[model samples]
Target chain A: MSERLTPHAPLTPAVLAILLSLAEDEKHGYAIMKDAVKPEFGGITLGPGTLYGTIDRLLRDRMIEETGTTDNERRRYYRLTSQGLKTVSAEIARLNAAVAQGRALGLIQPKGAR
Target chain B: MSERLTPHAPLTPAVLAILLSLAEDEKHGYAIMKDAVKPEFGGITLGPGTLYGTIDRLLRDRMIEETGTTDNERRRYYRLTSQGLKTVSAEIARLNAAVAQGRALGLIQPKGAR
Candidate 1:
């Protein structure tokens, strides 16, 4: 087992999506789920089980923290910690690299190719 | 629950890595592992168990199939099926979309940005 001081790469879809969502801004659970459905986020629809389960893991991992604001008693907002930002940035870099590789291999068509 | 056909998106790292590697060319197990170590493939290192297990699943899912090349009797080669190509292509597109979103949100630095 490799031991480095950050969340592992190849993050689960749920985790990656949630973190990316939070990276944009703090949001409640429902807002994260809504953002996930947009095409840019892979059109992912997170069921409650996956959404909350991943949230729990992120919290435990210290990648995310809940805001203490009391304005909304029913909704708890969450945001990315510094560690969360680092992890998501790393993950995106990995994806960007893979995309470049795909283009070089001709596996993916050039942009605007029909 | 998504009812759309094709393997679900947000592929596990192992599965995506193996498919992307094979997308380049047919290879035996060891070759796949070798490619996984490269930086562009997310630097994923699949354990033997995970490697074989995911291979089994991919075969069962018809995304990949044994190439039946007996030139090297000890090694079994594998390649992407049409389905596999479609799957990997879609996955890359999803990643591309996410990267674009990351940029728009300023979550990821613009290329060449310091």
Candidate 2:
């Protein structure tokens, strides 16, 4: 059998979006779903199943951890761990490099360089 | 049953890297594999099975099309279709937005903003 891929090796879009949502502050599942689908953030309308599934994977990888519940008691908030912070930072850097390469190849224009 | 997701709706990192590699010029599988594994591109070392599997899906989705073979005859080159071009462009825009959000939230620093 082929070796299984790492949990976050490729950082799927949904997972990245979820990580970005929690990057600033702790948030519940619904809050994350809302933040992720904002038009400015690519309008990714992740269904509840997909959102929680990604969250479960992220949690298992130790990239994110659940803190305490909010006043609602049922709402569990999540935040990025130290490892999660480092992973997200590295992912951003890699993405930045990809964008730079895209610009260099002229497939994409530099921001405000139009 | 939940609706099946679009092939490119949430472009995976490996697929995005493959599309980026073909954005500039048509390349055979090995050439794409090489470009994608560069450290700057996130060091995504895709196995042969994984590579071909992605290629087949992309082809089935009409995101990429196989052109005539190179001089080696066994080597088949692939290029982005018009739809593929549009898809990649949109994916990049989404990623840019994510990066911008990451910066605004102080989760990540801007390029050379140190």
Candidate 3:
């Protein structure tokens, strides 16, 4: 695993989005890209360079791994590891806590309460 | 304002935390640092270098601005501009949407149902 990420280190938004995309099932690069650009995810359009670069980094950090099963010979599928799951989970909790604080401070409205 | 941040650019976790911290009241650097290291905020310990560096960048970008009121001559207080408020609100919304997707996919449990 890459030493760049400590156990509790916060993730970049791009990295977090990619992990969220693969949280459910293994997916090819193209599929991950499609999921990332959804309007809810901020409509972030990752170019091939940004997408693959993040993939490589995540792989190096053992946050994600290439799966043996591939529907297409040319496409490689990737899935989150146990570590990745834990990381994303922690991140989500942190975000939730921050949002809660925002609401308490009146900086953000509660869901369906806007 | 610095040209570095686009209206829709995703923020770094540290930057986001700072914005969220100032969402309510204007605070000094030390106060911001204290809020940022809370357990719910991920306990991210920021040394003076990292804290001031991010503050400088945020000031340049107009995401935060120095307030004229100072409790101490040595400490400078900061508050979020309209731009900062909008940016952090958008980020929280994006994160909430991502969490919803994760829950729908069974990757994350619904709040209080975990």
Instruction: Please report the TM-score between candidate 2 and the true structure.
Output: 0.87
Q: List the candidate 2 regions with Cα displacement exceeding 4 Å.
A: A1-7, A39-42, B1-7, B40-42
Candidates' interface RMSDs, in order?
1.3, 2.1, 2.3
Q: Write the per-residue lDDT of candidate 1 for residues B23-82, one digit (tens) a residue.
A: 999999888988987878768888999899999999999889999985688898999999
List the DockQ of the predictions in order.
0.73, 0.49, 0.50
| Ranking 1 against 3 by DockQ, winner | 1
C-alpha lDDT values of all predictions = 0.86, 0.79, 0.79
lDDT of 1 by residue, A72-104 (tens): 788989999999999988888888888878777
**For candidate 3, what is the DockQ-based docking class?**
medium
lDDT of 2 at A85: 82
Tens-place lDDT per residue, model 3, B1-114, is 665445547777778778888886799989989988985444677778888999999898899999888868999999999888888887777776776676666555677793
Worst 10 residues of 1 chain B by lDDT: B2-11
TM-score winner between candidates 2 and 3: 3
TM of each candidate vs. truth: 0.92, 0.87, 0.88
**Residues A69-104 of candidate 2: C-alpha lDDT, one tens digit per residue:** 676977999999987887777777777677666666
Ranking by lDDT: 1, 2, 3
TM-score of chain B of each: 0.88, 0.85, 0.84
Native interface contacts kept by each candidate, as a fraction: 0.69, 0.49, 0.39
Candidate closest to the true structure, highest lDDT: 1
For residues A13-103, could you state the per-residue lDDT of candidate 3 as single tens digits? 6787788888867899898889888854445788899899999999998999999898789999999998898888777777767767766
**Stretches of candidate 3 exceeding 4 Å from the true structure:** A1-8, A40-42, B1-8, B40-42, B107-109
